[model samples]
Target: MSQSASQVYGAVQALTQSSDTLFLLLGAIMVFLMHSGFAFLELGTVRKKNQVNALVKILADFGVSAVAYFFIGYQIAYGNNFFVGAETLAQGNGYELVKFFFLLTFAAAIPAIVSGGIAERARFYPILIATFFTVGFVYPLFEGMIWNNNYGVQTWLETHFGYGFHDFAGSVVVHGVGGWIALVAVKYLGMRKGRVRAGKHTNFAPSNIPFLALGAWILCVGWFGFNVMSAQAINGISGLVAINSLMAMVGGILVSLFAGKNDPGFIHNGPLAGLVAICAGSDIMHPIGALITGGIAGAIFVYLFTYLQNKTKIDDVLGVWPLHGVCGAWGGIAAGIFGQTSLGGLGGVSLVVQVGGTVLGIVIAVLGSIVVYGVIEKCSGLRLSEEDEFNGADLSIHKISAINED
Candidate 1:
């Protein structure tokens, strides 16, 4: 039997939609696993006394973010909702639904970044509230502006600078904002007990180097999904993003290995700095450009982290600001340079526009964090009690240690 041409076209459309839905779902799952990476990373960094708390907090925060993003964040960012009837919702192979799941993972990352900075001393419920608030409100505002062009923000940028800010996988949108917000959290939470002496950090070393390495490895592996799957559909996927991400990661590892003077902590975290920086330009950048960007991010993390600990006495527990905030901003700007055709990129970027966007994200992050965290601190307190700090977050908040005994 001969079929109508329209029927054939419709069939092809269905198949494409189904394939795209599957692709995004896989990406969401991979990103979902990165939360565990967050868990183990913090778990490995803090003392064993606070290990259990670190694990519990990250998992719990994911739960909070899910609700906030689902109920509010998505609507604010893209002006969409899932309130339609079941039959209507089932259309397009549930592609929109899967996309929401994928982006929810990104929104959740904001709190995950904050978790590392304020670990060991923040009250659990308060942090959860802040996570909900930021993911639901603060992050989506800027995310909508840049990604969705809400309130003509992207339009304005392109009109004035010949290009809008281009963050292929959210260096500024996610990592930068998270990192900056983390700085505010850490500042308000203050240093852990015995963490400072006179004018320097007390230098409490990582509790579990193996766990730290494991966490880094997980995130490294998962980042391919983070950058590649960012295409969000089968047709848009590109191998350039994958290779770029790899080269950048390697660059970070080697650079930090040398710059850090054989410190295992820096060696593991080096790739992360690279990954964060490459997120904005991975799709547009050549492999060599990515390597340079990653290497620079690694050096930035090592040098600044050391200076903060040794001289400034800032207690950014895991150096989230350097690794994510500063490196994330670098990624945003690096895209403007590396993504230009003259430098082996696809070239739809402007350095001026990139800088403006980076600064805007940072300013939004700073103001939003101050307002949200400050209000919470004043209303209900953000940190654990002095006694709780001495006893560790595990024993103080959860009533159990990572290793319990009779």
Candidate 2:
């Protein structure tokens, strides 16, 4: 057996594929754990009565998202499908299937982000329908455009702007799309009942700080997988992405600590803002550039979150719009700036193309969300019945509380 060159080559190839499959599987599991982060984060932010609903929505939406992306979204984004026999599907250690698993987590995250904004008052099933439409249809189009270069978008960008838009881990594709879609859903749902009375806003503080912090920590840890594993192959993994992600996360924390004046909520969310922003550029950005990008994202979250709550009637429950939407957009643009060679990055980025691509994702998200959410509202209704809202999502929807009195 050792005498055959062909046998040795095949053995080596098989080993490489197996190793890569294992790497991506681990990454998928880590990102999968972030769903729990989403659940706990929403649970701690909403009123206590809505805690059960928060947990339920994350789990339920994940199920729906998995089905949607597997059957529909993956094909739409990457133009691949699972319409083959089991033997054919299992080829190459089932790497394609595992890829589907990893990317499904990202697709599912869009709905999770939206879940945060529309929590408390939304009807459960309609929200599921929204997730189906988004993960299955809307998000995939833009994902294909930038990531897969569908529609010649990257080619066109290169022809005109000298570089294709770069989003290493989907600052614009995932977070931007999710955040803007949440904005539309929030707009359609309107403020939680009596969020503002007599032109004065009423603030509802987070229900449990410990849970919120725990959620933040989980997401922070899981994000390393999110960024590093984007390479999809172990050989492609880079220490730069890891270090950049770290710098950005702390950058966000330090900036939010100062800008938010030590507010617990802002402090907890600060790292998320940075992480979200750095996702686009983590591969190419220097650590210092990542820190600035992340720090700015933190400031954006704190400032815009406060402004939206106080200066406007937009009742985004967890400030998803600022944390994801605005910060994600900032990350997209920041990548263009910081990815320049002069800035200690790998370069080959164009700022104008970055803005254009980011805007494209936003426009698609906003329009798609409006139609999808609007149709859902017209048919099944989007919000809970007033009685249900007053009683809270837990008792009204789930028929129990997070804590039970036996």
Candidate 3:
């Protein structure tokens, strides 16, 4: 080739790489904003007296997760770390740095999910410690197994079942793990004070519905980046992922509106439930299949949340188990079913592998949370004193409440 032709090719390659980097950077920012959604969602759900703690915990947990992932978790998951000089780190178009930012947002979400379940009573620093450990160690372990194909789990699955587990994004990996971990933490921390009495659950109405709705809206809008950007390259981006996400969102909304009896809280959370379920299959499932998957998730959340809170007295404040744990697991399995050619999907998934991978993820999450939270519980204690609980987490921990009158 002539020198002029070579120079032209170099320019085109540089432009493509730059565009991909920009695409992923935007994705990281969008997922980062979801942390605020987590905060405000808890802020609106918890009693006003505990609202400040909700905000503080989400922000603090993100800071801790960033530190942990930068130092250790990213390496565990992807065999890469920012240990070298900044000059060297910037060599790969800084794509690795942006990728870390994106996955770090996901790692931070574990504590954010647990925050809701253990809200109104958990000690702040202990939960932060849990955040550090979870992001640093627990989450990255399985993240490596699936996303990075570490330890040959995916390879083994593919060999045995003719396809590996197919979580295009992270339905089982992120939301499912976070939700199950939250369940264990909630159980260990015990119910919030006055939440249960004589086998009955008390109703604590959301303090600010508008804040709750705003948070849900933020998460809903940001989910496009979360799903679409998982493609991670300009050339790999897909209109199908975006459309599947939209269909699932509307399906969740419509179903939850019906299933939840028009409750505003449920209606807002419906889209989130759908998004969580569709994350695993967004790349492979048809839009109509995505709708069905999301509709089931919406109905599952409403019914199970009621049963867990009332009959089982689980006291999961935000219903993370139903919205994330179960629905996320369902999403993983649904990918195997709905991603089949027979189901009008892309057809490179297996039901057995999907079920196996989903269950493995939940098992790892449960064991990790139990060990981490159990140690924290025994050592520094996890819950507030009864007196402090009555005073509320905002006043007791942060020395302030959401509203005050002199």
Best by lDDT: 2
Model 2 agreement with the true structure over 1-406: per-residue lDDT tens digits: 4669888999999999999999999999999999999999999999999999999999999999999998999999999999999999999999999999999999999999999999899999999999999999999999999999999999999999899999999899999999999999999899899788898999898999999999999999999999999999999999999999999999999999999999999999999999999999999999999999999999999999999999887889999999999999999999999999999999989999999999999999999999999999999889998999999999999899988879
Give the alpha-carbon lDDT of every model: 0.94, 0.95, 0.91
Clash number for model 3? 0
For 1-406, candidate 3 gives per-residue lDDT tens digits of 9999999999998888788889999999999998899988989888889999999999999999999988999999999977799998886688878888888888888888888889988988998999899889999999999999999998998888889888888999999999999999989888877777776677789999999998899999989989999999989999999999999999999999999999999999999999999999999999999999999999999999988878775889999989999999999999988999999999998898899999999999999989999999999999999999999998899898777787
- The local distance difference test score of model 3 is 0.91
Shift in Å, residue 245, candidate 2: 0.1
* TM-score of each model, in listed order: 0.98, 0.98, 0.98
lDDT of 1 by residue, 1-406 (tens): 3568889888999999999999999999998899899889989999998999999999999999999999999999999988889898789998999999999999999999999989889999989999999999999999999989999999998998889999999999999999999999999998788876675567889999999999999999989989999999999999999999999999999999999999999999999999999999999998999999999999999999999887764688889999999999999999999999999999999999999999999999999999999999999999999998889888899988898576
Worst 10 residues of 3 by lDDT: 192-201
Prediction 1 TM-score vs. true: 0.98
